[model samples]
Target: MSPSPDTSTDTSADDVMEALVRSAFQVMGVMTRISAEHDLSLTQLRVLGILRDRRPRVTELATFLGLDKSTMSGLIDRAERRGLLKRGKNPHDKRVVDVYLTPAGHELEQRLTDEFRRDLAPVVDRLPHHQRVEFTRLFEPLLSPPLVIKPRVTPQR
Candidate 1:
């Protein structure tokens, strides 16, 4: 008769945090290498990923990336020159400028994604199938939009 494997371990919070941070670094390293191969900075690669599905206003995109408006504009300007993205007046609000990915940008983004997946496959494949599914399920919630907490207003008596 054979005994089942032990699946239990005393994992401390600090240990978990360290693991997460290390994992982030590994993923970033892969992304950075892939980005460089395509002659893009990591931020530029991230911009392509962000613009893949949504057309966000300049300010909104800047806020999402934690960049100052001017800095974001410069980044966009460079990308535009490379024909990866474009700026246009929003249809609903003509005064607002929105950013969209060009077809070329989409192609590049797809290639980056494929390359990233390919490069990361070895690390990911180390986990068993069930563990991989569980890992994804646990990580998905972390990718959700941030929760906004509006301040309460006090009425004057």
Candidate 2:
């Protein structure tokens, strides 16, 4: 695990901002190395991880990945060529195409996820308790959209 930054002394707002960007880069550097080892970009790794559960329309995938549709198409094309994923007509809708990870792709994604979890556990564990909690409180919402509840349906006599 990386050593935690010393936060004991008085610090200015500018210092805090710089520290935040530095820490973020350190984390990103680690991920970049991991991605390189697997011959994938971080974005490709994320795509495989997302496809582990269920297949989705290409546009849906694009939206979820925060990528434009045309950009997503090229990414999918690359993955498809690498035999990591397949594109075909959606099972529920013949008109729409969905993407799915191949077995090899799923296996690779699972392995990477497991390894990251194990490797990051110590780093996360070293975080100050309040910082750890605050990090989750602050970032988890940014990662996911706010949950929306469905309206209840009524049965009429």
Candidate 3:
């Protein structure tokens, strides 16, 4: 059965849902263009963006990125070959290599983020001042907790 429509406006719920999807795609388009400007794929940009703040091992990164180990390894390998990042062993173990962004990685990440922000600024600025403030307030909570850039550490078994 179809769900009841929103009472707040004449627009149907489907319209609002469709608008959300379209808005997401619009953001994605901007993201894709920004990623291309830095010569990286969307997934690669995603990985670097996640690594911008802190380092994580391959296993942990895979879980956070929702990628398998082999796929994550390939991304890391390509990035490493491009001099964007490097792998080094965990301080307490000779075999556990952690991934970290290099100076170039940091530079690219920063540029990609800055450009994306610039691209988005106009969109947000087009809204009325109250809507802009409310949007920022609403968006803040979407980035907390489980969305952490660094995964929580667990004791080795």
Candidate 4:
């Protein structure tokens, strides 16, 4: 027998969290495969995506990627050797270094982005046009400024 549909207008927070997490995983899987095709680590692919629009300082990049200075330096070193990115002195501060993508990196990033959209088309197409528009409208706010969760500290007795 087919499952009966309940007429519920409200969705619980748990349900929303579960849905978002599952969707993120699905998208990540697609990205992982695409990154592998380009012989790049997922983290490296992420760096390309991050550098696509903005040029940020090395320390800032490390912090955003949750990597320590040394580790972040190593990753950037590898990418630089591969000619995917370059580091230059920040115009305002000669002591600060900024990382940005090379032309090759930008081209690859664009191709990867295109592939991602193509791969995800089937899932997105499943939704009707109006629902797709509504989905984007609802999801856009969650992305801006990024999300951060800080640990809560309790006072010792």
Show where candidate 3 strays beyond 4 Å: 1-19, 91-95, 128-130, 145-157
Global lDDT of each candidate: 0.89, 0.83, 0.85, 0.91
Candidate 1 wrong stretches, greater than 4 Å: 1-11, 146-157
TM-score for each of the candidates:
0.82, 0.67, 0.73, 0.85
User: What is candidate 4's lDDT per residue for 56-111, written digit by digit as tens?
Assistant: 99988887887778988999999999999999999999999999999999999999
Query: What TM-score should be assigned to candidate 2?
Result: 0.67
* Ranking of all predicted structures according to TM-score, beginning with the best and ending with the worst: 4, 1, 3, 2
**Pick by lDDT: 1 or 2, better one:** 1
What does candidate 1's lDDT look like per residue over 1-157, in tens digits? 8987544554675677688899989999998888889999988998999999999999888888877789999999999999999999999999999999999999998998899889999999999999999999987887688433334579989
User: How much RMSD separates candidate 1 from the native structure?
Assistant: 9.5
| Predicted model with the maximum lDDT | 4
Tens digits of per-residue lDDT for model 3 on 1-157? 9999766675675676677789889999999998887788988988888899887889988888777789899999999999999999888787888999999999988888889889998887789999988977976775465553445579999
Off by over 4 Å in 4: 1-11, 148-157
Error of 3 at 58 (Å): 1.0
Q: In every candidate, how many clashes are there?
A: 0, 0, 0, 0
Q: Residue 91 error for model 4, in Å?
A: 1.9
